[model samples]
Target chain A: MAARSLGVVGARVVVVAAAAALWELVTRLAAQPYFPAPSTIVPRMYELWFSGPVTHVFLTDDALDTFPPSLGRLLVGWVAASLAGIVLGLAIGRSRVLSDFLDPVIDFGRAVPPPMLVPIFFALFRIGTPTQIATIVFGVIWPVLINAVDGAATVDRQHLETAKVFGLSRPQVIGRIIVPSAMPKIVAGLRLSLSLALIMMVISELVGSTSGIGYRLMTAQQNFLITDVWGCIVLLGVLGYLLNSSFLLVENRILGWHSRARQNA
Target chain B: MLEIIDVTHTYGAYQALGGVKLTLAEGELVCVVGPSGCGKSTLLRCVAGLVQPTGGRILLDGVPVSQTPDNLAVVFQDYSRSLFPWMSAAANVALPLRRKGMDRASRRTAAMEALEQVGLAGAAGKYPWEMSGGMQQRVSIARALAYRPSLLLMDEPFGSVDAQTREDLEDLVLRVCAHHGMTIMLVTHDIDESVYLGDRVVVLSRSPGTVAGDLQVSLPSPRDQIATREHETFVRLRAEVGRLIRGNQLSPQET
Candidate 1:
């Protein structure tokens, strides 16, 4: 197993290297101003973002100006949406009255595209971090809510009966039984929302915002600095990849029991 | 003490149980036997307060059981679903004790002791899926034991395991009842198991079931699987319970 995984990693590295080489060759030979070669883009990216004192962790002034606010907004919005979604989802899922009342409303809201709501959110909050955060939370909350509802609703009959027989209180039943029972679904929803949160983060910034990667991408494009535009795109891609990888790492650790149990079954 | 006073339950138009009556004294082990769909499980559920009968009532220690009673636990047949997969064996056992107001350390100690009672001390840290079906059932039994309930209900608890495992679990139940002095009402379709495990066997009629017969088990104490099965009294009682069950199967529905 160890050797097989190592071989897979080796193949991934080779494919990435070959792809980069091909892109570099094509762009340089074509010499199109619209598509800068990786060679020039790499130097500009390094100078813009990574050249700084050791104390600043190699972040230049532009890097400090751009990365933190965007990341902070993304994280804050995502966490808020996750917390609200799970709480509301569990309530709606477990209660017949609440579900009956809210199901149609949730369905209608989830159907509308999130990007289209950005203008409305901007009108409500008026072009600032609030608007951006509002846009992100609205866009990403549905997956978490839908999945949590499904998870909490479908808890096994035996588990619930056992909990009842033991005379568990409402909180004890929810905390000890329902939440853990619903975790596999909850985690799936969280992972899906994380990717959606990243997309929403960019879209929110692309329309309005002063200092984010998305803002940087817009300015670079308007200035016709095509290489910087490419740099911003590459940065967003790296950010998305890192966020997803880290999320998976945490998920695997916490949900090890779920997968193992599934295998056993 | 537990008493069922003419319990009747229906699911929509279909009656699951009809006018069933029984009683269990403190520290008694009674096995309820019947054919499939005979409402043996429904009867157990009514007593455990998992289901409320449409008519009649259950009283635990002179108090009417509208909700699940204190100091009560159930060991369900589907151990895989009953035991929480996310929790370790010890954690599952310890979960109910939170209601007992046990501190974390004491809960852990009590859970360990219960697991040891079920002969699963070494498997305390393992999750339910990591163990065999019999082992998982043992964990569930340990959970009930840790709760130290005044009453324990088993609804076909050994039905899902292999024959050998079922025998081993039967003996384990007997030993736990003796050791803990817990009042138990075990439901099963296996007639021989009813005789082997219970101090008395109560047979129920087919669907919309009612008590058909009740017989005392006179086998020797500290029952051995081989010796108890070979005993004349044991054989006679098993045959009697079997006859009662088969007779109920052939009879017409009684109101």
Candidate 2:
């Protein structure tokens, strides 16, 4: 298994390198102002992020300021949305009445685009961190909420009967059988929501925020710093990839049985 | 002891069960046999108080069973769904014990003991999905055993297993029931199994399931799959019960 995963990682590295080499060649030939070669972007990324004093731990002031706030906003918003989504999802999923009554409302909220809500939220909370956080929270909560509801609602029928026959109380049933059964799907939903949270984080800051990776990208664009813009894009991609891998580490541990079962099958 | 008196159940306009009456004495192992779509599962659910019969009542120890009684447990037909896949086998058994206010340590001890009883002590730490169909079913049985209920209801518990595994499970049930003197109502469509495991066999008709016949088995205990099946009493009882079930007639005088 370890050898197989190693091979997979090796192949992925080759693919990425090949793509970068092709991009560098095409852009050098074209010599476009908007499109910098991979070589330019790599050194510029290093200069922008780690061009500070050697004693300063390989991070510049811009890196320290922009990266942390973006990360902080993403984490806080995602965590809050996840918890609230699961709790509310479980409650709504378990009851036929509440789910029915709230169906139309949930549909409406999910239907509205995240960018469309940006203006509405800007009016409510002003152009600041609050608006940024709210936008992300609003955008990412739906996938987790809807999937959690589906997962909780569709727990195997026999398991519910077994719970009843065993004399487990309503709360006990929900906590033990319902939630655990729903966990795999909930984790899947969480993964989708995580990516959405990253996207929403950038979109939220695009119009209002003073600091963030997105704002930095916008600033670089306005200043015609083409290499910095490419560098920031690469940085965002790496950050997104790292965040997703971290979530997977936890997910694999939680749903280890499910993955093993699928592999054997 | 439990009593199902004049129990009638309907699903919308369709009558699934009509006047199904049964009386189970203390420490009795009864097998309920019937054809397909006979509502045998519904009867077990009604007994467990998981479903309400449209008419009459189920009385456990002279008390009407409107809700699931504290001392009753059921092993559902689908072991894959009944056992929580996320939990270890022992944890699955221990989950029901949580409501009884047992602490974690005691519940673990009891779960281990119950798993030991079901010959699945080594499987305690394994998840249900990690095990085979038969092993998963054993875990479900262990869970029911761990509950230490006064009455146990098994709804087609061994229907999904192979023939050899089915016989092994049947003997396991017999051994466990004899050892604990636990009252059991096992639902099955297999004829030989009904006589093999049950002290008494109750036959039901198709569709609107109701008591068609009840036969007492005088066959000796410590029954072997081969020897007991070949025994004269086992053969005679099986044949009689088979005829009665096929006939769809309640003839107590004939038995």
Candidate 3:
């Protein structure tokens, strides 16, 4: 297992290194002001991220505090969306009446393009930070909610009967049997939601925010600071990868018994 | 004591059970044997309160069974379904106790104890998919035993297992019931199994099912599979059950 995982990690490292080398080679060959090589961008990213006056300039003003405000808004909006979606999904999934009543509404909402809602949110909430967060929340919630409902609704009938024979009350049955059985699908839904949430966060910031990586990317484009724009893109990629990996780790811990059996087979 | 007094069940317009009556005394292991689609399952479900009797009443100690009673548990034939896939064997056994207000550690201990009773103690940490078909059924049995139900309802619990595993499980069940003083109602299609495990075997007719015969097994207890199969009384009882199930009427003494 250790060797297999190490090989996987090595393959990822090689792919990332090859991509970076290709980008550097292409930029060096073009030698354009718009396209900067990794050698030029890497030092700049390191300085901006860790050791330079970019932090002072960016951190001093609340409107210029890109990293913290963007991260904070992302966490808050994502958490709210997840909690609401899971609760609503479970309620709808467990009841035929609720599922029938809400199915059309959910289908319609999910059908609407997430990014297209930005203008409506901007117009409604008037382009503030809260509006940006709301846009992310609105865009990311449906996948989680839909998947949660599917997961909860598809609980094995025999397990339900087993719970009944054991004399479990309705609530006890839901908590002890339904939730655990539905977890794998729920985790899959959360993974999709996490990626969508990140994308929505960047889009909302790009459209209106005074601070955030998205705003920084836009400003760097206007100033022709190509390396800084590339730096922000790299940061977003790393952030997204970290979020997904952490979620996978938690999922593995909770579902170790299932995965372990699969491995043995 | 358990009683199914003239119980009848209908699904839409089709009648499943028509006035089925049966009685089981304390510590009695009664097996209900019948042809396929004979509503033997319907009778067990009515007694378990998984389904309601449309006409007559089922009573446990004189109280009518409208819902799953507290001191009863069922072991279903599809072991893969009866045991939760997401849980460990011990956890599945402990599940019925979640509503009984016991602490988690105590539930685990009780579950392990039951698994030990079923000779599956080493498989306590294994998930349902990790175990073989027979072991999975044993896990289901362990779950029921952990609940310590007064009346145990088994609906073709060995139907999915191999013949060898079936014989072993049948003997194990007999031993456990005898030791626990458990009153059991087992429904099966196997004629010999009905004679082997049951103290009394009740045979049911085809759908709109009704009782055809109820014969007492006078075989000695603590039965060994090999020796019991060779016994004259066992041979006679099996033949009698086979004939009754085939709708062939024999004399009372022959049955």
What ranges in model 1 sit over 4 Å off?
A: A28-31, B250-255
- What tens digits encode model 2's per-residue C-alpha lDDT throughout A1-265? 8999999999999999999999999999999989999999999998889888777788899889898889898999999999989998887888899899987898998998988988988899988888888999999999999989999899888888888889899888888889988898899999999999999998887887899998998888889999998998898899889989999999989999878766654
lDDT of 3 by residue, B1-255 (tens): 898889888999988898999889999999999987789998988888888789998999888999889999999999987787778899889988877788999999999999999999899989998989999999999999989999999999999999999998999899899889999999998988999999999999877788989999999888889999889999998998888878633345853
CA displacement after TM-score superposition, residue B227 of candidate 1 (Å): 1.2
Those runs of model 3 whose alpha carbons end farther than 4 Å from true positions after fitting are: A30-33, A52-64, A123-126, A261-265, B248-255
- Whole-model alpha-carbon lDDT for candidate 2: 0.90
Can you write out model 3's per-residue Cα lDDT over A53-121, one digit (the tens) per residue?
565753334334678878887888888898899889988999899999999999999888877888888
lDDT of 1 by residue, B1-255 (tens): 999989999999999898989998999999999999989998988888888899998999999998889978999999999999999999999999989999999999999999998999999999999999999999999999999999999999999999999999999999989999999999999988999999989999987889999888988999999999999999899888888888877536543
Q: Looking at candidate 2, what is the lDDT of residue A5? A: 99
Top candidate by lDDT: 1
> Could you tally the backbone clashes for each prediction?
0, 0, 0
Candidate 2 Cα deviation (angstroms), residue B27: 0.3
lDDT per residue for candidate 1 within A1-265, as digits (tens), equals 8999899999999998999999999998999999999888888999999998899999999999999989998999999999999999998889899999999999999999989998999889988899999988999899899988999999998899999988788998899888888889999999999989888988899987898888998899899989999999888888999999999999999899999888888
lDDT of 2 by residue, B77-186 (tens): 78988888778999999999998899999999999999999899898999887888898889889899889999999999999999889888898999998888899999
lDDT of 1 at A157: 88
